[model samples]
Target: MARRGQYAKGAAKRAEILAVALDVVAELGTRKASNREIAARVGLTQPGLMHYFSTREELFLEVLRARDERDHERFHSPQRGFQSFLDVIAHNASVPGLVRLYVEYSAEATLEGHPARAFFEERFVWVRALMTEAVRHDQAVELMGPDVDIPYVVDLVIAAADGLQVQWLLDPSIDMADRLARLWQGVRETSWPAVAT
Candidate 1:
């Protein structure tokens, strides 16, 4: 937490620095991005970068936090719909470079004592739980078929999304968004109840 005097300005600068770090990571990839390079790219001095993110760890953590923020925003948007899910997939695919960083970091975060250990754990938990709830909501509204197992189906959806991201990162030629939509259509069709005799 920040002190009162440091609230607005300091936090805003910190967020700005983090935003610049995202671009740096996207452009240079995670392993090659350094504080000096990030600072120079963002029009900040090295010390200025340090002022916002005291260490490389802090900058990296901010990147992880940004993922959570992006998901939360998309989930909460008033205009959210099935199209939003497609949009999220398409949007991420458009920035294939950043998606690659996410895939690499997610893989490394599973290691013992990794700095992002708790972050990734909490992130997966929240996202999976959120997807389950989304399924429930869609079900009650008749948007999702009640015959489908909500929890299990949610797990499948989220897992497939993550798995597709991994493959897409490895080979951009793969039509991940098309694959996801096809998967969605198949599942949605499963939800449609059998016609009465």
Candidate 2:
């Protein structure tokens, strides 16, 4: 019982630390954020924080994961389709730090042997699959044209979203939400070409 209590306390402390780290990253950006700063905010010395997270990358990864969880809850909907995805992208425009964190880790995680490589690999695969499923669902219900090529359309939507995020990061004036909505609208309008049975 005592051991379980200790573990529970540790988990709570880790969550507290991650919460502060998120705010720190948002204020300073991922490049400028540091473990020392996070530790200070959590009332711990650098070494003390390291006891909870062995390295800065681990802490950053945890922070990213927490942000993903919050975003997922905010965006995920039971009646999902293209419009739901657009809504999520619109939400992202308001949280540039979370977007920046994802972009940075995604690039860095591509390097062989990086600790975060696996996490990003799984995330990409999962998101691509989810979008693909969403597209198929739309087609099944006649929300999309049966003539639509599922694989091609799925890849195009995901690619555009990812590319637009980078562009938005570089220039906040780009209006990522509007651009994505327009792209989806074009897809919907042109995707409905009649197919003869």
TM-score of each: 0.81, 0.88
For model 2, residues 1-197, the per-residue Cα lDDT tens digits are: 99999999999999999989888887777777787788889999999999999987898898888876776777766467666677778877777777888888888999999999999878777777778767776777777777877778777888899889999999998987788778766776778975689
lDDT of 1: 0.74
Q: What are the RMSD figures for all models against the true structure?
A: 3.1, 2.4
Off by over 4 Å in 2: 194-197
Error of 2 at 182 (Å): 1.5
**lDDT of each prediction vs. the true structure?**
0.74, 0.82
Name the runs in model 1 displaced over 4 angstroms. 1-3, 74-79, 192-197
